[model samples]
Target: MADKSSNASKKSFKNIDDTQSYVHHLVWLDKNIENYTNQQKLNQWHELDDNIKLFSHEEECINYIQKQNDKNTESYIIFIISDSCSEQVIPKIHNCLCILAIFILTTNSENCQILNYPKIRATCLDTSDLFNRIRHCIYRDEASIGFSLLNKQDSTDAEPISLETKSNEQYPIRNLQEDQARFLWFYKCHNFMIELEDDDRQAKEEMISYFRIKYNKDKRILKPIDEFEKESLQDNAKNAIWWYSHNTIMFRSMNEALVSGHISTIYSYRYIIKLLCRQLKTLHKEYKKSISNNRLHLYRGQRLKLSLILLISNHINDLISLNSFVSTTLEEDVAKKFCLGRSKNNDEAVIFEIDIDLNSEQNIPFADIRDVSRYPEEEEILISIGSVFRIISVNFDEEKELYRIHLTLSQHEQLIVNKYIEQTFATEIDSDDQSILFGKLLFDMGEFEFAIKYFENRIRCLSDHNNHYRPTYLNNTGVCYNQIGDKDRALKYYKKASDIYKETKNQRGLGACYHNIASYYYDKGDYDTALRWALKALNERQQYQLEKASTLDLLGCIHLAQRDAEAARNNLQEALRIRVKYLSQLNTNHPDIGISYFNLGKLDSKLSSLIDAQNNYSRAEQIFRHNYPKTHPLITEVTQCLEQIKRQL
Candidate 1:
């Protein structure tokens, strides 16, 4: 007799629990879920994922799945259904994007009679079989990679912008399309992980400690965690790929973090990520030497959501970057099995046909890891994270009933990314420190929370009390806090930074601190205090034209608040003159120039100079629209102001 308790435990769920960070959920839907045997099984399932939700009613389960789908969270569902409820529940939730795979539990497998639903991955009569199938489904879903599409419409030319060229400087590298910016950001993150250095013992201990806390409830995974801790201490880098090949906590956590773009989680797994990349890079060099063919073909098949397929289809000839370390095979048939197994209505079967040129000088690291893999028969070729590939075509194979996306490994996008970073580093961000630059990059990308976390981590790592970069880091944290609307915390960090700058006698740093303090006060409508700080900033920033302009702009805003129109006009005009002269040499459409124009327009509007206000607002609108996204607040605000100006005229 089979144990009904163990069998029921194999069931999975769909809905995500807010408290848990699970990428895969197991949803068990059975009416008799509260029965003694099933209740025991539910306890066992809880070991797998404590967030698992057991629903006795099919409608309740359906509603929960629907709600989760509407949330569009980064998680997938493996649903377990009893034969009685399969017909009622599967139909309603099978089409949900969150549904990864479905398993039907039946007392009699032969008479299951479930419809041929694409999500119906298996029909199991026994506990052991059901358990194995559910595990397999979860692993397969984990193998399904996430990618970002870079449409040609969103792409810029690959030609490197010369800082020396006055014409090129007028269009700064920072003015990148959303897709291009994301691609470069990922590239930079990959590099940061690979190049980051830390005490191996301490990093390993921290990683293991995190794993223990995460998987403490799951008894099955505890042994593997211990084994990894011992094994990693011996030689982690050499066995990195081997460990990753197994369906262990390391692989699961790393993949989940990467796919979701969870920066802090990824940072925690930096030790393992660095190990894997280093091993792959070494194998890549060796594999290159041994290969006789200059060209190679690879394949990876998985079910992609309809939206993703449409994105890829629309962006043919543009670039695509895999978010996680991708696994591909030389055997197309093996690859096809993954996608062709079951396709939910919301997602389509996709087989990626990749062409690689071994002779290309510009290539991201990828290597055949057969010898190093736990499952060597899979003949897996692991591509490093953030590898760029140009989409050749997207075609449907009528007979196979699947879409085939053709891609060629390309270096053009990488070159463009390098140029953008180089230009930004040389001109805008005056920092040689990679950590500071990375934090600044995150800030520029409008990832305020991540930037704050990153800067905080850097601060924690600093041993020198009087480090010159300390004030800058503190100020950067303050800036991020201000952006996120944490006014109190933002002001606290600014004051901390101000104290450091005074002690270091760093004039440039002091100027930035003063300006930020003034801006904070100005935001609070304290014009008197704002003016005092602005004057101090202006004095300290006299040698730095760009910094001086910013201080003047703040002073102008303060004077306007004080109702001193003459003072406001003088300050605003001087600020505008400085901004136009400096910014025109490096992107006249810069957001700073837009700020100046907008402020001047506000002053003009106050004085009842409708014509001057209209002209200033129009210039500000043009610049804001050119620089920011259409949905950006600045664009909407300026558009509203322009409408008001038109009504007044």
Candidate 2:
């Protein structure tokens, strides 16, 4: 037999428990079962009839997981727990979707705590509301962590099901109704995991054998798509939405197949590179056509073409580096499709230095004074940082083992005239005049500590003066503190900035500070305070459409937290309208616009506006489809929402 450690190193399962083909069974234990063996615990809930493996200890289970190195091997987890200890243990193993939690509890009140976990379905020896709630949860499709979608049938429901405890706050569980359908179906077959006193042994074995076959039939048949097939689909793709769905599914299948050591997956990925190259070529042609037709002056058209070219280039680079262990054949085949950073015969070449004078069109030649030698010696030229140059030729030097690059000013295009001036002793500094430019630059670059230092220096330079820049610096410093997770410090800075902005009558600054404060309170679950500040920020930001839209979105969230559906819908819809308008003006869809639509969709779904919700969800899906990869949370979220909506319709 092969060494277990060596086998573990070869396996590459991307998401083990996430695949729907896997089965999840919940096993429960009495809170008093203190020192039972793993087998004893499992035996208390499940019958030992099928091929299911059981381990007594967590370490033994982990080792078992490590040894299942074969790509085709199935993955699953079992949690044997009592009611009291479940909350502590479940969250640790919650990431494994294939795992099932069996809660050994008898009362409906105890079952309420388990409702916070969507994937968990409890079965007691005695009858309880747990079964009925499971049916209701499934019917509503609320098995995921998020707000429950509104259903008219639930009008008489007393209160919104709060997932966490009132006394000790914890993460809320989103109820996914779709999960109910699957779990309910599975449960009806097996009835319960724990063997009952009146249970028939022969019948239990039959049920176990029946479930194993049912699980295998549930697996989705995914196949790797070839380059020609993908190209054909791309050509037929009506819009970005079409491409998004196709690429997402195709890549996911390819990923799964590749991780399993499938040789054909490499060919599919190679085809993806070809497609990217084709896209780049098309963009290049459009750019050239625009230039020839004298239409390059159209900024949007030029920008679009350039953006597409850059996007394609980025995709190509990403694909090439995706797998470090790519076979030699695949690497060589992909390399043949592109020509870059390689030697080409020179039509004409020359070496020259930059002519710094703005009025001069000609460059200066480097001093070459080796007339006695077979070839003239090359002279080194010094230039400041950010100086632009054009390469004419690149010749390899045999003696130095380096490529001697030749360049000239006229051969290549220059995007910008460098304007960087070195900060040195020669440049005089004025201490009294405060400037936040360095601080702002550092903040933009994410150097928060250095940015804080610069902001402090600016404040010191001002000698405690109340200037226009002071509030801006304070507000930005607060933003840095918030990003670095020092909420107390962030709130303090925001308060100071707010005071300064109000004193100076700086509406924009005050609005931003209010928004920051609202965000802080929101994080702390102080919805009332968040709502108050959000309203103020929104009122102040009426003239700033984008910022106003953001504030409106925040207001929508606060309203949702307060369980005021009508107010949430109004705020989210307004945010969506403004975001849509913004994107329309730019003639492009943005991820933020998609998020606005998604928020509106969630609110609409909650109000039982199924058609409106579906429409908004479709639009959000389309936007996310084009802008982000399939794995992006937004894309998956919208996709999942759409699936639930479809079932409802």
Candidate 3:
């Protein structure tokens, strides 16, 4: 089995010789990774690190690990087996980790890519005894929280991230593929809103501890017991009891996080689904015998996992839907809008239901609803439902689980009726948000692995929306493909967008597509072709008075490439002028403006405007020095230009 697994992994890698795969990516392994103290770990990994030949991209690595659920997969094995380690044996892996840590930071929440890799800190050793209790409080399933060693260290040991310091603290979590260092970036921007007195520090810390305990509970897990080789009936009971408590905590934590308005750790959700996987395997393991109803508590774990999964899905709608439950009259009006009624006898046999309670204390009975149509095949529900739901009353009830689904039907405009309501309802669900979000979220997060699907769906949706929306859709599709490094497909979409915009005479859209295509050519070092397209884009932008500053800068770059010193000075100077006029006032603290100024200075020097060029270059150097890292190449470029200009003076 071990050999088969090793070979299976090897089969996933055959292109190690590709130059694109080794863009000088550094792999620093920690030497102090308990049980990983070999001399190779001490030095940069050389010849022996070829075992990890699975993926080239970060997204591929994520998907690869997710597919592996076998009980045999070992963490930190890559540290020993992969060729990434074979590249160099840095005298220290810790030295590498220290430098790498500084670059990992979050700009906003959700879908942003994180840079820090934490393979070891996500520990399998569930040392905190209270973790189970916290898990029960957060999730309705215990097995959702597992324990396993997360020993993916390089030659240098990386530091573990500290847990949150506030009990009521909210963490905006991105997708699970993001390591913990990247995950914490989401919480940086939001101004957390909570009302507490000045002396509430201890209380806030306690609140943070509650979440920390649950959050720290492990994701990937090892087997449940080491002494299982001699397990008896006594051990079964203990395991069942422990798992039940964990499930209970997992349920509560997830639900509270949803309603509390904090971004959630996607790890918790993945952990729950994986718990379902484990439950299936356990059921198969116990299939031959009939132990007790308590053993079925194992299935109970899976059930809890599934429910919380559903709960999270529902929360997006529930949270975004807003407070509308004012009066029954409002519900009637909203229902009237979505009623696509038939004429005369209405022999079409339309079936629907709306459950509205005239009873007092109208809470979120609207949310308890899982579905909205009596028809089993519900495809176009969210749009249809949302169009009408936006006008109605939706509020929480005394029993938090119960919700009212209000429906109404009309025979053309002549006849109408409401039916089947005892204050609770069920309808077959139709989902659309998942499809819409699939491409958008993944693309935004730099996880291009999944964006292709969603972009396709969104394009189809926009095409169906109206003729005017198609250009925007095409442009977005092009951007997604471009980010994923599929320049050919990106150009195809940009061309489509450009064609569509031409038909509509939408100059901005046309210019933007040209700009994208020009940038693509520029990056490929096709100077003449890139310059031609960039000029074309500029002409299009000026024809419509579009935001031409960025386009102008590109045009300037093209002239510089052509070595047209006179034309380059004119274009680059104009581009810098436009940026200075519009950018700061527009509230864009554009650090790239410094680069543009430096470019203009170079053009001036080539045109023999040395003194004027020196000032421009000096300003560019100062701006780049202030806004960007001291080591950034832009600073060096500006410095060299300024120095050369000074020497001429």
Candidate number achieving the greatest lDDT relative to the actual structure: 1
- The C-alpha stretches of model 1 lying farther than 4 A from their native spots are 1-138, 152-183, 199-206, 231-234, 289-294, 305-311, 357-363, 399-401, 411-422, 427-430, 464-466, 486-489, 562-649
Candidate 2, residues 329-356, lDDT tens digits: the string is 1121111111111111211111111222
- The TM-scores, one per candidate, come to 0.67, 0.33, 0.33
lDDT of 3 by residue, 506-609 (tens): 77778889998998888678988898888888887784322476687777777777787767767766776776675555323344467677777777787788
Ranking by TM-score: 1, 3, 2
Candidate 1 lDDT over residue span 485-578, tens digit each:
9988999999999998898788888999899999999999888898899999999999988789889988988999999999998998898899
lDDT of 1 at 338: 61
Residue 86, model 1, lDDT: 81
lDDT of 1 at 148: 58
- Please report the candidate that would top TM-score against the real structure: 1
Alpha carbon lDDT of residue 522, candidate 1? Answer: 92
Off by over 4 Å in 2: 1-457, 587-649
Q: Evaluate model 3: give its TM-score.
A: 0.33
